[model samples]
Target: MKPFTKLVILLLSITFFVSCGNADDDVNFRLNTGDGLGKGKEVDECLNLGENDLILSIQEQFTTLPGKVSILFKVSDSDQNPISGLTADQFTIYEQGRNDDCFNTISTSESLARISPNSQVFSNNTLLVLDLSNSVLSSSLTELKSASISFIDNVMPDTAQESFKMAIYWFDGENELHLLNDLTISKEELTMAINGITDDISNDPSTDLYGAVIKSTDRATELLNASTQGDKIGAASVVLFTDGTDQASRFTKDAAQKKVDEADPNISFFTIGLGGEIDTQVLTDIGKTFSVFAANKEELETTFNEISTRVSERANSFYLFEYCSPKRDGSGENNLAIQVKAGSKQGAVQTKFDATGFTGGCE
Candidate 1:
């Protein structure tokens, strides 16, 4: 065969194999193209490239795409009732990425209410890293169960479009990574998985808090890369429930904390120190690695409730406003001012925004 002819055939064969192989692994590269002006049904459907576009040397800037925005939240109200039927215009979001107006502004309320058309991954994955070592199991178990049920029942509403992808792991004896269920909104399934856990069940024959926490999130890091969204997760976070002691494990508490921090700065590690035996120093360091979190049991439940509520609020609400030009003499980063505008004719531009920098980014 002539060299040119042989090369042509070889290229064709490789292309053919890649096109039809392992559909699941086909990372949702599908670029959604439209005028960005909210158009017809076609605009709402995520686009899968066609043979015609392929030949045109079409390039999709999804990775370098600066406008992509993402946030994971549930729904609730001041009284904590599940708020339903939100619209895209009701909320606002401001985005900032490293080293880059890499900033983005868009109305996500509609996307939040319904499933985002552009996103292939449905569930926003969450890891509930628990400490089940016998050392602190008795006191923390009950609270953990209550929190787990509340999390499954309320925070993660079982729906076909969106839900929390959750896993429950603990270190009771040896390392116990209980059930790492794939992202699903099945209330029954989640409840069963969370409550079915028995500290008695061990991944090994001995105690393993550090082992379980470290390993669970390590696995989660890999999973979140293609986290349900079928894309790389920018802010994958964790809701850690632990007493914060490392009596048994292949890794130490410091090692686990370092790993998690480097894995995802957005991984919010919220700990629940159930008893005095709970190691506050270790957990505090863990939580501090991500964001400011409570350190004691009295504060633990409050923190859990607060964290859950904030996440839901983020889901249900939106921030709406015109971008203000940054000051010429000031630093590139400008502190934004946001007010509820609950009532018209509110006094001077009230400074409603706080150090947390809205959306609970924790400044």
Candidate 2:
């Protein structure tokens, strides 16, 4: 696609999440194809206000302001290796600053992540970045395919599996980064997409992983931020699989990482390196705040299984910490020492330090 044309697609895709159009239009601008488009809207024919009714426009609006909180944690077992597979049942959750008038009350005192009792309205879609750089790697992609099938079968809740989709994109081919929509929800279709995976090294047509990651993450942000059915949407992590480094990307690693962090503060990232030439350190650092793995298969099967476990539990429970100041102008240097303890574990992140900027009424 031409650069200008691709830009148009990118902007159109971003429209799914961004609040656009006003009362006159029926649809909100930012939309997530993965999350499904909004159904039709009810027109407010009566512009006049009544005791219980007010005629407003159709476009969506952002009513909530950004909540500020810093979270930090350290994962360790008795032997000090980061452990996985524990469910929400195994931990305790807590919040500080209850002494001040901010939130209603402390939910718990143990500092574990609070699992919402409500049915999850979110989707955890994984966009698989398959590697097809060489013939041997192409064969290995089949193993990856088998692993992918097993992943869907084991990890996803049966009812939501159709909603929890996966997209396939292979590097170094005629259409190297195209989304395999047929494979998005079907194991059979995924198999077909993988079966046809091949490596392309032509000069006129090329592969650029940086561009792909940027594009994928941009798409993901839209999916997460979209609102449907009068509620906002959410997503888990992006699991990336690649056998090689960024050989032809338009953007640098720093730029991509910054973009991701800005888009969604809570979205986790994970990666899988399929072969020997993969950059283990780069992948590890890329997901430094979240999770990352790059390995060859003497132990990769085990790695993938562990990846499944992490994602499953994370989908069930997420940690949210909130800290706030007292009313409008009541200011004293608000310094807090907060800690989250799970079993015998202890973690503390520096909350906002001395500040005096809130001149208006606190929420």
Candidate 3:
């Protein structure tokens, strides 16, 4: 064959292989083409996607209107570690009850929700409540500060988006929760607040651990409630650290426990105790979500790191999956499932969404 003809043939062969590979990977759909392909009825009706990523967990699912549903979920590895950097192409949404036995795949272009590269989707608020009692200041103040700074560094990303914020509060003998720093996304600011802690920051050195729990939980609950009322999704993490028991007795233990129990589930509570001075049972009850104890000051950082990992993972794990549903009110309730594929690994989850109020056509 002529050299030019040979080159042309090679190019054509490459293009054909590439096209086949893409079709094997994903079925791309043009959402608004107004053609039969864009009308949501052209793709394969397969019920399964072979294998799926099993580490995904769905937390909440709700529909704002007809033909649209939003899901809040988390993705983790086999060891239950949060997985990040996933994109919309890695997922295939299927709906069964809306149509026939075959599952219809929601187009990637129609997926409005995705795992953000930044922390935008995960609007997280964290509160660090410290007990600045004399007992803690006299013995392990430096260790506490170091451990706290480590936690802030681990949890707070380098570039602060509007989605993530942190605040610091210190409690002495008083029943009040003194604010060391207001909510801010700056790691430097949070570190500065921790470093600024000194023995003289509070006039009374007695620990009001119970009061701190009550006040911090209340504050977290308020933040979460405000976010919800404002039509935004938000989560809060409250980490309380103490080296001794509640000495002020300004608030009863039962009151503090009740406050925590009554707090919103969106707010996660974490407690850290140093030495034997702290009541493990009390801290555990207060930190029903998670609790850690350090035998001494040297182990504070390790304990704090464990809690920080959990909080940060939980904060960052949230993934929002939004898609256009084919079902209308007449469809009643439908069976929905999501399968995630990342590289060669796969996971799947099944959930149901109501089409009771589904009205206008899906966007």
Candidate 4:
């Protein structure tokens, strides 16, 4: 028989067999036609896949279960715009050992990332420390309250994650560091706490700015430590507002600055200074992450709002990605490479994880 006639017969026979299979069978099949040159292949060779230009920025990753790994990442195009509308099938995972130079692709069925949208697994905490000394109260008490309320409104979104919380604190010349409100997720509670601040609330007229800084940093450190031990990721931001120098001098400048420097790297520090009496150099040194200054009471609201905007953006940018691992318990340490494709754009990122407990089969 001629070659064309034989090919026709073979195709017909295969179609007949598939049509006659049992209806309850769960198996699926596909036919791959050869390239024009007759080199049988599943992919088309004529299509052009230009240079890969996507950005897969992986922020944080962890192993949540015996065989599952979770990653927090962001996807952006070459122009830096966030890439959306991507499905789980668009990702390909490859695995290799520490000593291997080549990566072997894991099966799409076994190692695909189950992309969860807008899932914030990490915890975020914010400490708002205010100076309630005579200097600030006599000059800008009303303005201060307005700014504080605005900051709370901006930071706490309508659909905030359960892990997001904020605390309010105030300090004066007296050694006591008053807690206006403990860490909470309720906007109403925070607003009520800010409204309660008044000139008569402070017993001393002096400003113990240094003491407040030390206490606030210590509180943030404790939170971070507790969360880590509880197997939860924790991030804290300490924003202190002051309008004058440390007049009480209860704690030395060196002691206060040392506490900030020794703080956990995960905790961010932001300082807002109002009026000309504030020591710009000292506030700048204290605000390790960010600092803003207001010439007078009029600018206080704007300064607080600026800091609030930045914090909100950072919180929303994070993501969580999880996948099952092909490695078994005794596979030792291995490397992971993830590739993403959207339209014709593509990019890749690599990370390493220890497989000491990577056992069991995924469901």
**For each candidate, what is the lDDT?**
0.44, 0.46, 0.78, 0.76
Please rank every candidate by TM-score, starting with the best: 3, 4, 1, 2
- Poorest lDDT segment (10 consecutive residues) of candidate 3: 31-40
Q: TM-score, each model? A: 0.51, 0.50, 0.70, 0.68
Residue pairs with backbone atoms closer than 3 Å in model 3 (clashes): 52-346, 52-347, 53-346, 53-347, 54-347
Who wins the lDDT comparison? 3
TM-score of 4: 0.68
Ranking by lDDT: 3, 4, 2, 1
Which runs of model 3 end up more than 4 angstroms from their true locations?
Answer: 1-70, 75-90, 96-99, 106-114, 117-122, 322-336, 341-363
Q: Judged by TM-score, which candidate is best?
A: 3
> Residue by residue across 152-261, what tens digits does model 2's lDDT show?
55556555453355666555533345665432556556656655654442322334555666666776665556522335345546666666677666668887666655
Cα displacement (angstroms), candidate 3, residue 230, comes to 3.1
lDDT of 4 by residue, 1-363 (tens): 999999999999998888778432422221001001011111211222344476666656777557887776656565544465567788877778755666777776667567764334567789999999998889899999999999999998676556678899999998878899998889899999999887799889999999999999999998777655544566788999999999988899999999997777567788999998999989999996689999989999999999887666545434466788878787787877777787878866677777887778653
The superposed Cα distance between candidate 4 and the true structure at residue 116, in angstroms, equals 4.3
lDDT at 150, model 1: 74
Q: How would you encode candidate 3's per-residue C-alpha lDDT over 255-283 as one tens digit per residue? A: 99999877775678899999988899999
C-alpha root-mean-square deviation, each candidate: 18.5, 17.8, 18.9, 21.3
